[model samples]
Target: MRRTLDRLYDGALWLAAVTFALIAALVLVQILGRLADRAARAMDLPPPGITIPSLAEFGAFLFAGAVFLGLAGTLQAGGHVRVKLLVRALPEAPARWLGAVVSAAAAALAGFATWSSALQALDSLRFNSVSYGVVPIPLAIPQGVMTLGLALLAVALVDSAVTLARGGTPAYRASEARTEADTEASTGESA
Candidate 1:
């Protein structure tokens, strides 16, 4: 089950990567189109005026998708920015409890966001809402992707909270420990 969950998280990150790649490709096409037009005009010829329809809108959607889709994986990988100074200052037991409390709060907030986003997506789907652009894309598609990402993030937060409650270090803590260990090793080697 753990392996499956990890794979799911990895897949989500991969999806985000693919979305970013698509965005880059679209932007490249748009840039090339503009350059071509400029070249034609400079040659005193009629510009082809070739442009990617809805490129801006599509790029925005893809960028949002990439960010939202990467959330769960980022959290799991301990890549999310966290203010750990206070937590590090605390005693072991207190820090553990504090971490658990923070995780629970994060889970609640993420769950609420997931539910709200899902509702918004459903509403868009019901109304057949489409984005205003040269090409009309259904708003629900991006909203659904956002909701899925939020749901995954909520699950990860909950898992971390449960692990902390059970006296197990969370993945983020483990990652930090590994980093600290490596730093110590390097320092010792230099000494």
Candidate 2:
């Protein structure tokens, strides 16, 4: 079951990357069309009537979408950066315990936060709340994507904690520091 979960997480991360690429293409088209139409108006070469998306606003929105979705993959792949100053200083035994505690707490907190925010965003969408836009997009969509990443991060965190508590982290040897990145495609034995 855990192996299946891991595969699912990896697949979702790949999906997120694809989603980001798609958004990028959409934004590119939107921006180019708007700019072209506006340019024609400025040159007085065509009818001075053109109303398209506000490139700046759309750009921000598109960027947010891409980032949130992309984050899921990154987080799942364990590409998120972590500070290891204290962990590195300690010897193996103590460091292992400390790492487990930290990982568990971090996972629980991040997961809870994301879950809560996703619910709230969903409610907002249901109620048709509009923030600074003529057309309101359902906030839940992107928020949900961000929540997915957070959930994956939570899973990774918990897995790390379990392994650390057992004796050592799976991807990390006793002496060296393994950046969370390597865990994305873990090749070692499971804890």
Candidate 3:
């Protein structure tokens, strides 16, 4: 189960990376197209009039998808901002309890977001909603992606809570520890 969850998060992160790459690719192509058009115009040739129909809209959608898809992976990787000063200052038992409580609360919020986004997606589907761009993108598609990401994030948070409650170090906490240790080692070596 742990392995499966890890894979799921990794896959989502991979998909997010792909989306970002696609955005970059689109921009590159657009730039190239404009350069070609400009060169043609400069050479007394008809401009190809090359342009993406609704690049800005597509970019916005892809960016939103990428962000939503990255949530779980970022959390698992300890990339999310957390105020850990209090937790670190406490003894093991109290720190564990506090962490568990915080994780549970975050899980609840994630679950709510998932539910709400899913509902919105469903509603969009039912209404046959589409984006107001030259290319009519189904609004449900991006909303569904958001829902999936929120669901994964909720699962990760629940996993963290359970681990902390069982007196086990959560993946994020372990990752943070390793990062801190590495930083300290690097500083000591430099000194």
Candidate 4:
């Protein structure tokens, strides 16, 4: 039973990663298209691509989507920058416990927010709310992607907390992988 749920955590993290990449690609396409248009305009020609999105709005959504999806991986890897001074001073067990508790709270809050926002975004899309532009599309469509990222973050957090509570170290935590990779690279060796 626990294992089934555990899959959800890791799976969600993977989902977020893929989603973030997709959002980034979407944003990049929009940017390049605009740049092409600018180059065309300079040459006294029509913009190559027709504008279908409010670049500002879609860009914002892409950012939100990336951040939300990336948070779980960030948290797992201890990439979340915090004041290490205090935690580093504590004994090992205490440090671990404190980290677990804080992470649990953070996960809960983030998950709840994402779930709520997703629902609202869905409703907005249903109401046929279209953005004003040359090619009008519903604002809620892109927001839905952001919502997916946030929801995944929450799932990843819960997975981490549960695994820690069971005395299982999350893959992202202080692991031997970093040192091993460094040693191999230093020795000009392949693993």
Best by lDDT: 3
Model 3 C-alpha lDDT versus the unseen true structure:
0.94
Positional deviation of 121 in candidate 2, in angstroms?
2.2
In order, the Cα lDDT scores of the candidates are 0.91, 0.66, 0.94, 0.69
TM-score of each predicted structure versus truth: 0.91, 0.70, 0.97, 0.65
**Per-residue C-alpha lDDT of model 3 across residues 1-191, encoded as one tens digit per residue:** 88999999999999999999999999998999999999998999998877888899989999999999999999989999999899989999999999999999999999999999999999999999999999999999999988998999999999999999999989898899999999999999999
Residue 64 in candidate 3 has what lDDT? Answer: 91
Residue pairs whose backbone atoms clash in candidate 4? none
Worst 10 residues of 2 by lDDT: 172-181
Off by over 4 Å in 2: 38-62, 70-72, 75-78, 168-191
Clashing pairs in 2: none
Residue-wise lDDT of candidate 4 within 1-191, one digit each (tens)? 65664465456557656656766677788878889999999999988994536656555655666566566566656666666676679997777777678769978888788878888788888898776755576868667766766766676677677776767776556543575577889888653
Alpha carbon lDDT of residue 84, candidate 3?
A: 87
Rank candidates, TM-score, best first: 3, 1, 2, 4
Candidate 1 vs. truth: CA RMSD? 1.9
What are the RMSD figures for all models against the true structure? 1.9, 6.7, 0.9, 5.0
- Backbone clashes (count) for model 3: 0
Kindly report which residue stretches of model 1 are placed more than 4 angstroms away from their true locations once superposed.
182-191
